[model samples]
Target: MSITEQIRSLEELASVDAELKILEDQLNQERSTLDALRGSLQKLEDKLKTDRAHIAALDKTRSDLVAEVRQMNQQIEHSREKMNRSRNEREANAAQRELEELRKLLRDREEEIGKLTTEAEGARQGIEGTEGEASKISAELGSQEGDISSRLSEVESQKAKRVTDREVAAKKLPPVLYRRYEQIRSKRGTGIAQTSDGTCKACNMALPPQLFHRLRREPLLDQCPSCNRIIYFVSPAAAAQPVKEG
Candidate 1:
């Protein structure tokens, strides 16, 4: 390619690189959001599983306590009836002692049942709250997943096209120039830069007056002294060309 043609190709390659970067950033951000949503959902599900297991254990304990308390009440009644029929003070006192023991055990069991009931209720309430949060996150994830997937597909498609464009642009340059451009892009994120008013815009440094004048008068492949980026001068007409066309 002629020097001017090669400059145009470099510009086109730069544009493609810029677009590709934007596409990559979009993809990363979207994927990160999707992963975070999935992670949150998984945590909530795990907590629900553990809480349900705890509530089940509490229920089993409460049931056993209730049954024991009922049996104790029956024993207390039996002791009272026996005391009523006792013929002497010794038998009556023995029945009274048995009744007191049964009542104390029943009281303790009832208190245990009460504490278990409170714990179970608290756990149930926590589950309800977690479920509500999970539901909200689920709905949001469902909606976001579809939208982000569509957007990611579109970005990938655009990136593919830009890649092809970059390849074509790269091929237009001489091999040496292409390799140099690639090296510069790898290190600096961009290979070429423009000059205006004797300054290398890439580095904000003044170009050599002799070099700047020559670049403006004739197209050439050159590098800025300060930044080492490929340098070009934008003639008034060239500057007016549409960016994509250039």
Candidate 2:
């Protein structure tokens, strides 16, 4: 094809691509809401796992504390028997001091067990609250997913049609030119921009007078120096061609 015809085909492809981009943005926006909910649910689940593990550790510590208390009680009982059977004042005083120390240690340990019991209870309640919240979100997701899925499905079908249209448009161009367009589009998100005057709309930089004049005078496919996108001129005569009534 001549350069003019190639430029026209590129222009057509660019138009289709612009529409495709809008659809793509819409898809991302829609998916983001669902993704955010899923992310929140995942965090809750992780917290529940951590809290349960903590509760289990607390229970183990409490059990060990209880065993220690039992041993302390046994020691206190033996000390009491020794005091009752003491032969003299010195022996009775020694047994009394030992009994006091053991009782104090027992009291401290029992207090710690109480605190642990409270902490474990708090963790259990937190797990219950987290579970409830997770259930609510799961239910919400189940309710919302049907509508979101249907909407996404419809958009995907539209997107697929445009993808086929893009393939058709791409096949019409020479391989080298198409490759160049794809490369530019990968970097700039667009491959071409039209100019009626000398201004590059993509970058908003005015083209040099000589460069703009050449593009207007010739059937050339040129790049905007500022943005490096395939640039073409829109002549007044061509722009003035009336749209036909369908």
Candidate 3:
């Protein structure tokens, strides 16, 4: 391959590498979103469990109150029958007062039960809301997971193709040039750069006339002074040619 052809190959590699980077970023973003959603779902589940437990405890308390009130009523009824049989007027008066006090206690217990039932109902509503939020998070997480998988697959395939192309291009270059390209690629994430209209395409630096002329002749492989990237002159003709033609 001519010097211009090599430069063109490098440019193509850069383009592919750029695309690969974008896909990788997108894949990473999707994975991040999936992780965040998973955390949210976990929190929602924990909240639901706590709410359900609280509601269950309230229900148990309410049932106990109902049983206690029923026992109090039975005691009052037995006391009234006993008072009627004995004909002890003062004792009957004491029994009646005790029964009245028990009735008041029952009324208070009933009121507490009503309040507790309301609280339990509120807890149930909270649990339902948490469950619904968890479901939504699960669905969103599933979608993100699928997108990440698909994008990762595409990135891997594209990366493989880029590797193959890079290897092919390396074969066409001199050993010294290839080595220099590798060094620059490691440092700057790019192996080669084009010299365009007296400027380095990699760093957009205007080159000295002497350096520009040196690259135009394709002497030894050149590195850009500003960017440290391997610089080569791009032939207008080579740029116009298609990859298949090359």
TM-score of each: 0.70, 0.89, 0.59
Candidate 2 error regions (>4 Å): 236-246
Q: Rank the candidates by lDDT, best first.
A: 2, 1, 3
Q: Give stretches of model 1 more than 4 Å off.
A: 60-112, 208-218, 236-246
Q: What is the C-alpha lDDT of each candidate?
A: 0.86, 0.88, 0.74
Which pairs of residues collide in model 1?
none
- Compose the digit string of candidate 3's lDDT tens values, residues 1-246: 666566656666666656666666776776677678888988898888888888889999999999998998898787777667656878888878877887889799989989998999888888888888889888888777777678778777876777777577657666776677677777787766666466776677888889898777763357778878877776655433221100
Candidate 1 on 49-163: residue-level lDDT in tens? Answer: 9999999999999999999988999999999999999999999999999999998998999999999999999999999999999999999999899999998899889889888
The best candidate by TM-score is 2
| lDDT, candidate 2, 1-246, per-residue tens | 999889888988987888898889888987997898898899999999999999999999999999999999999999999999999999999999999999999999999999999999999999999999999998888888888888899999999999999999999999999999999898888888666678776777899898899888987888988888888888765642221111
> Clashing residue pairs in candidate 2, if any?
none
Per-candidate clashes come to 0, 0, 0
Q: Report the alpha-carbon TM-score of model 3 versus the true structure.
A: 0.59
